[model samples]
Target: MMGPAAMLLLLLLLFPVASAAGSRTLVFILAGQSNMGGRGGATNGTWDGVVPPQCAPSPRILRLSPALRWEEAREPLHAGIDLHNVLGVGPGMPFAHAVLHSHVLPPDTVVGLVPCAQGATPIANWSRGTELYERMLTRTRAALAECGGQGKLAALLWYQGEADTIRREDAELYTGRMETFVRDVRRDLAMPDLLVIQVGLATGQGKFIKLVREAQKGVKLPNVKYVDAKGLPIANDYTHLTTPAQVQLGKMLAKSYLATL
Candidate 1:
């Protein structure tokens, strides 16, 4: 009952939407300090044959390789062995798997991760004015572009604050600065509705940890979600997470993200 011209126009209008619906692509930004960079070792098993239940061939998961390039050790030249040894499983993999299992995405959905993390770097280091943060931002932008542009970015997962806790004044300014950083990242990426997952630091004990948690909770951003790492076990180093604990944390992060979707 439709004219040829009308039908053509309708098809034109719906083409992009239909295509997007058919193949959903999610780009996840993983940025923070050491934890976000993944301190654990790579799995001895092969990942090529592994596929999450929800992932399709077209929209596959992409993770930044050559790990630890972004880890900012005190000397900046320290070997990554220690960091790699403790590395078990981090949040990125589980998050992707959970999204697929949740069935919240379309068929042929691909999830990508762009990790930019540095150890021993304070929140201020990621500030807009700082060179370190600027470099990180540049790298993140490049990674996103390489992955397929803004359409790919579904969320930004952050796990930091340990370094900031070392200083009382920095701790006081953490929340506001974090808010600003999130805003800046959104603006830079030109994605206003991008979800942000802020994982609170897992320091064994202290009022400082509590303050950081309160600050994250008080931020009041609708798209910003918080993950608690309070009771999680830590590595023998007393700061980082053990391999098993990291795996659990990864699962927890995936669950949190899935809940939002």
Candidate 2:
């Protein structure tokens, strides 16, 4: 019943759909500070010398570059987060691997990571309407657009609070600030039920570490969750997670994200 021209048009329309069939992209926003940017074993504070099995390369795992282009994800996921530091192993990749291979999401799904973490950044940096916050928003939007506007914001992974632990005022106000952050991020992204998985502090044992941890643990948002970093091993700097710890933390984060789904 269809003409040749109509059949040709139909085929053209179906081509893109068939090309994209059975392949979905799971987008995750990795935002926080230095630990989130990764600081694995380095040679003279430059270049990451360690790459664990959990952080191995995979074509299916992609990252948004500083130019806002999607590329194969590699270690030191946050090159756009900080220009000065050499990114090493972080929890982003391991988490992606776990989620992609997990039963929760489609096994054929491609994992997309939008890294926007900055080293030593405080929760205040992510305050709504601020420079850093605006930058994160822009980068996140760019990543979403890169997925042909078909991907989803699977989760916003946060691993900050160390810098806030340096001051009582910052720590004291962490809970309120974090509450605002969750609300604003969800509101801006138009995903009210967005999952926010916060990784509790393992570094910064002194100062207001306890207060910050309590604030992170006390968050009661609808879909917000926290992952404990207690007893996790740190690097020689005593502030960043070691290679093994990063792998373990990634798995823990993946598990937490899975529970929310």
Candidate 3:
């Protein structure tokens, strides 16, 4: 079977880049743990500072910084937001680039990425009403308002679950937690049928990884879809995705999103 990287290349060869979309910037939320925040180049307490062209900065793709400012996005996107760690290549920019060029969205549409994932956070922390959850919502609303017009939330991209795999109870109850998180976000965002793309774990920090993985895949929401990252290359830590793999995951996400339309 073709691997994700090759499949992404195939998608590129098969589709034409779109050129027109709404005038308002389309936004997406990047939520989850360290992997989602990105630990690509931070293999040993430091980021290698390598930015692949796929994940490079662009005027069309923007990131909402920790201070809620929209800036031209680059690697290590969760710099201050996912505090207490070195950052590096993440799926956010790559996803944006792929979506920008894919038939999914117009090539000219501005993509706004809201980086709200914090390293070491578990699904429980993201439950509605918690500081983590409230903050994500607050930051997203602020970021959208910064779009200079009536920007719409295109979708939400989530990559997490490592924190919940540490114990039997957490792993077992993850289905409920995961379901609630998605449901609550949709409710609060007033986007009842929002497009949600969730990345399945490539690896985990605990033995209950299988359980958490199953829960993630079991979500049966209307527009919720899962992109497998199980076989993707991992970092030296065997947890977070590497730079190239992150790019592949992004394209995979774009493929999943485009399939829905």
Query: lDDT of each prediction vs. the true structure?
Result: 0.61, 0.83, 0.84
Per-residue lDDT tens digits for candidate 2, residues 84-202, read 78778889999988887787776667888889888878888889998879988998898888788667878999999999998899998999999999999999989999899999999
Tell me model 3's lDDT, rounded to 2 decimals: 0.84
Off by over 4 Å in 2: 1-22
- Cα lDDT of model 3 by residue, 205-247, tens digit: 7888999999888887788899999988888787888888888
Clashing residue pairs in candidate 3 are 18-107
- For every model in order, what is the number of clashing pairs? 7, 1, 1
Task: At residue 75, give the lDDT of candidate 2.
Answer: 81
TM-score of each: 0.71, 0.89, 0.89
Instruction: Report lDDT (Cα) of residue 158, candidate 3.
Output: 93
State the lDDT at 102 in candidate 1: 68
lDDT of 3 at 107: 48
Misplaced by over 4 Å in model 3 are 1-22
How would the candidate models be sorted by lDDT, starting from the highest? 3, 2, 1
**lDDT minimum window of 10 residues, candidate 3:** 14-23
Candidate number that wins on lDDT, 1 or 3: 3
